[model samples]
Target: MPTDADDRVYYVISDLHVGGDEQLGEVEALPELLAFLERLERTDENAELIINGDAFGLWEITSVEGTDKFDYLTDTYPRLFEQLRTTGDDVTITLLPGNHDHELAAYDEYVDRFAAYNVTLVQDDSFTRRVGDRVVYFEHGHQQDPNNRIEDWGNPDASPLGYYYNTLVTSRAGQLSDRGRYNWLKDVQAVTPTERMPVWLLSKYFYREMNPLLRYALVPFLLLFNVSAVLAVLAGLSLADIWSTPVEEGTAFLGQFGAAGTALWFLLAVNVAIAGLLLLVGIPLYFLRRDVRKTIDRFGVFETTLTVDAEEPYEKAARERFAADEETAIYCYGHTHRPALSEVDGGVLVNSGTWLKRLHRRDGAIGVLPPVFYPSYQLCAVRIAAEADSVAVEFEEIRKPSPSTEELTLTERLLTLGRKPDPELPDRAEIPNGRSATPPEPAE
Candidate 1:
């Protein structure tokens, strides 16, 4: 059905990563997603639901063949697929391949298969649509990334660094965490800067694998060890007489001991202090030397910036790029997994963040062996419509009625310890890719 009217609506979202793995299938916000779809169906009948990329997560598949992923996805989430089918009846469903699901572009059958469900599969690298007399660019935005960008964009056999990362790190986490007390492995994909993955993996081991009593016992010692390290440094300075009063002023203090005895006393005191520190901190450091070193190496300057909570550089770049193109008034894409909407120059850029759980660390809270996965939902979708003179873009965080944490499994509740307070969004959206311009729907 072709619409000749200039006033059009585009409903965009990305990085659904449905059937991400057995564990991802469990924690996915399917209810919220279905609700979002249903709401869209009721709002705009001719709207196009654009799933920009990484929709299926075929790269996370360990054993399934390329072509069988659709069936696997359908089998894993029957209700979700059914909702998609129903929603497709009301709105046009468009699928664009991202790096994780690049196989979709390589296999034409995927297009036909989705078409059977009233969904349209786009094999191109990007798609453009006209809205309000201006061209709007829609792309997955993966090519800009060094790790995920493929040399041969649409080739299925071409492997990018991201493919290996997913296979080795992501898929491995999937397999191991699937067996955990909670199906928490799906959050592995939420990590950014990617360096944090190993640290997160270590936390997962401590929480899920280690003996509870033994682990709790180590917590106190671990904290004491930090204090011990600080004390050791102070002992070194004390021995050097950095804080000492002049010998003339300290006559009473030294008068109690002979000249040589004074020097010996200070040395003995410093040595004893150092010895105590060695017992408290040095012993644990000796035992966990390899781990401590690995932690230091990971955090010691190179790629040290934890980009997870940081605003994505790609979003800024995309906004600038869109601003340069005069004809295009809007640029919409979604690889960063953080929803955003902003005006750049005469144009605007929108990023549809992932449907998966997002972990947000607080402003200044550092954690001790924190949970690998922080429980959060940044589930959202972008609604784009033509206005009188411009294209109106809105980022809406999808909300759903969730059960109490008591209903959550034991492991799920355990994963919430040391988590940051719920992140606060500002009232104004302001510029490109910040918080939403309008207030997001209140949490249910």
Candidate 2:
């Protein structure tokens, strides 16, 4: 709600990560975005669309520099640019720079270039808009993130920890993605918490890139690994005269099937032997790993968890803002790519989520297989407007099917049969005038 206009509406989205090099340049939700923009163009309401942050994957565009990156994006996504131009004519459109697209703030040329397409680029880290009697604070939410926070906000040379990560890992993945068997390396950005990327790569390599013959040959051994370890333990106990031999009984049962049974028993014996050797070695390795971890802790090598707790800093900032301004009713942002809405003090803390593909990790039901990263789409627009005596916030999802069939191998699909992600969002929430009601339960 704008103080000057009671009917004004705000639509917010973030982390589009639209522009990149080669395979990374692919925008999976481009159709939905185009349709959304067209709808905005047709709307009669007084609307303002704000791209909270990381709208462009400027960090992934390593081939170009400065405003040339903007040129590349415009040329590459002419349709999207046209839609933005059309939508901007009817509704005010604002773009905020996030960690990936920090170059937008670093270069003055971006302001003019984006304006040519009717996108008003906001160079500051955060801004506030009045909603009825209260105010809503808007930011990309990267300032509170240590890895992405820019010490010199608008300085071109101000590369944070996240900058190098995008350069070396994300961009490189884009350049090399097509070389992979399934062309999936470009999705390196979708793995949340950043720490899961290595495991994700291993999973993809095993399921998609590994040789089928080798994989199948090893499947039986892997599937029976735990059973073999137990059998090996029982065999050791029998050898030590502490227990009867279950291994012998099991092999005798198998031997009743003749040559095939003998072969199966031989395989089992080999497996047991290997498992026993691994167990003996693993015992020492486990202790060694613990000692190494302790030493690393002593040296303070990893002071923080792989996935930083995104809630603490942002919530702390929200609390501070609430304490400072009694009129502030909403603190909305989008950098962590998690769509969430909950009451903070009397106000609501909201995350806009992302337009990019989201990967939900699903552990293997059994065995030591790497976890499958189930892909899904959470394309959404967060709408905020006036609602009588209270401020209303709503999350509207743009439905789109995930590319699991194309992205995941058959094994991955079989392993994660019934565990598809179905994330819940609070359909609509109200920030009361009194600022005392509990937040509504998230929609089922």
Candidate 3:
């Protein structure tokens, strides 16, 4: 059993694309993050910080060129690095290269740049560390994705959409310049539309279709019509009232009753018709839309999966080569932007989730401004503690609060945005590493 003194905690974070197109939320979270680092400095002295991957959106800047990328990195990432350095002077910072920043795969440049900042660059897909008696493994989880799997041939370089876009269509420049060699193929092929067309079209369609003003305008009419329709149905059912009343009373009652019946019946029919229409037409449309979305999502999944799997052949070879060596407890990785903690036959696996804020389709019906939900802002970490004859693993979230609307002033907004970073709380820890360093006992 490993002693308590040997146990250690490590913080893992990923996908902090410091200088990408969507920098708003990250920028907002910066001050709070700085403060959080200060707090960490004051507190957790022994913990190492592992930045899983995609720290920089290098692919985005490749076409743009010099100084811009450097300026952006210096302006944003230095604050983050400086704080980490100040908080944990002895702390080792391990950075795994991810797809977005695949340049890290070329280790020399990364080592040179990040070493000065006290960040160690890890070029491999998997890394292992020991705390007490526990062996922990880390990898970015993209290997599990199908689309980006490295096994896929001729995928584009590290950019997110570029892989699928390039794979499915020939570049215009290639078509034009390589005419002689590819002329036969080009002559038979259909020209691909702009890569961005589908996304742009969907965004525009959703914005106009889901407009709140239209929903609001229809709401009152819908309500009034429904009410009238209900009353009309009730009146129609009350034929006795029409037949039994005196002349004067019957005349007045019949007029009101008939009107109500007519209104009620009209509304009921309209609602039924609408519902029927929806069932017959809207449901199919809904399914079609979902299918389209899934198709697009699958493209992304394929690229991610392919890239990871391609790298896996080498990993598998290494594992086999070292099969007779010392048994390892866990395997953890975070380069693929997927979060997972699972026990495997030989070891445990951990994937630190990404810090990239995923852009979801905006829905205008919910608010004055369209609501853009960022799906991937979560920051996660793991703790490994020594138990009797084993080690326990745990996960945590480093949550930050949303900015309050009451604080509208510039100073107030900054202050609100700068609230203390929440306590790094674990979600689940204590799932034992399944396969022990020792070989399993033979069948009893």
Candidate 4:
């Protein structure tokens, strides 16, 4: 850490993923972002805002290539560019390239263009910032990910697996999002762990795109699937004379309701029949899927876990950096979109999370419905600076209401009632002059 730079405060954020064609261009927190910049402009402290990586979604821009992507971004988001200019005038703003915006390093035009707007495009994969006597290493964190890692940092043709993902799926969704009954497909980026895409698509189709009549008609069967399965088992046991009493009692109990009793019996019978058929078919499909997965694994075709077990790689990387540079007190990054603050080898590790609407997977309270992706915002800026004799780190959450009412279906809301993401971040984390103790718990 540099001694002369001790007085300056640093604000870090990443994975804003701005700029794409059509629905991908929609930044739900645009107002919040502008307000954050405006607040920075009015601050009295000496501050530098470091966008660690992925300030733009250059990879998702199917409409343009190379420098034209920046032009498209500036044209599409004039207000954002204008705000960046305004904020840059007041606060030092710096940007580094992530996998999504690797083009920032590839094209030399981006440096001058970003400079015109007051953002210093670093054109590198990683860099270090100093706060007091401690150093914080900043990277996009994609280098740890096999699918997104770029072997050649500035090569224009170096496309990783993640590049194809954005191009084929995310960009395509953006272009066709409006064609859906609800513009839900645009949120494909919010679905973490790329493996969840198929399930997410199914959930969206059922809750948002499926015809209302068909959905409503099938709701009863889906909701009572478990009950039906249990009843089928009970029926089989009764036929075998192992559990005959319960069935007789249940039938007699319903028989007292006359016509309604008849209807109830009919529904139950249909449910049992459907359950039996499903069991027979699902058994074969389950084994088939297992076999396919095993074959794929054997061949090592798709060996990525996407977002699963996201922390280990970054944590290991952070520890390596700490070992390599003993002066380093913080390792800051964003890529997993999961914000965390934890002690690592006498130092602190920080993930700056994303400004994009986060999708928290919520399973059905009962039955076998597809997991509902509840939407919320964890928009935050990590501030690190000198506080007296110690180096201090604090998280500042940009408050935004969960878009549940607007984004979720009534069925989804009911199924996931009283359940929504409320992530906690340590209000303040500090490393003492000697770096001997663990940080305290978050403030109440």
Give the candidate number with the greatest lDDT: 4
Per-residue lDDT over 130-181 for candidate 4, one digit per residue giving the tens place of the 0 to 100 score? 7777788999999989889999999998899889989888899999999999
Error of 4 at 386 (Å): 1.3
- Which digits, one per residue and each the tens of the lDDT, describe model 3 over residues 27-80? 444665577567556654466677766666555443344334545676656777
Clashes of 2: 0
| lDDT scores in order | 0.67, 0.87, 0.49, 0.87
Residue by residue across 317-400, what tens digits does model 1's lDDT show? 656766566566677778877666555554666677887766553221222345434446677777776655445677666774
Reference-based TM-score of each model: 0.75, 0.93, 0.58, 0.92
Error of 2 at 320 (Å): 1.4
Ranking by lDDT: 4, 2, 1, 3
List model 2 lDDT by residue over 139-187, tens digit each: 9998888778899999998888888889888999999999978888988
Q: What is the C-alpha RMSD of each candidate to the true structure, in Å?
A: 7.9, 2.4, 12.4, 2.9
Q: Give the Cα-based TM-score of candidate 4 against the true structure.
A: 0.92
Worst 10 residues of 4 by lDDT: 435-444
Write down the TM-score for model 1: 0.75
> Model 4 residue 410 lDDT?
91
Clashes of 4: 0
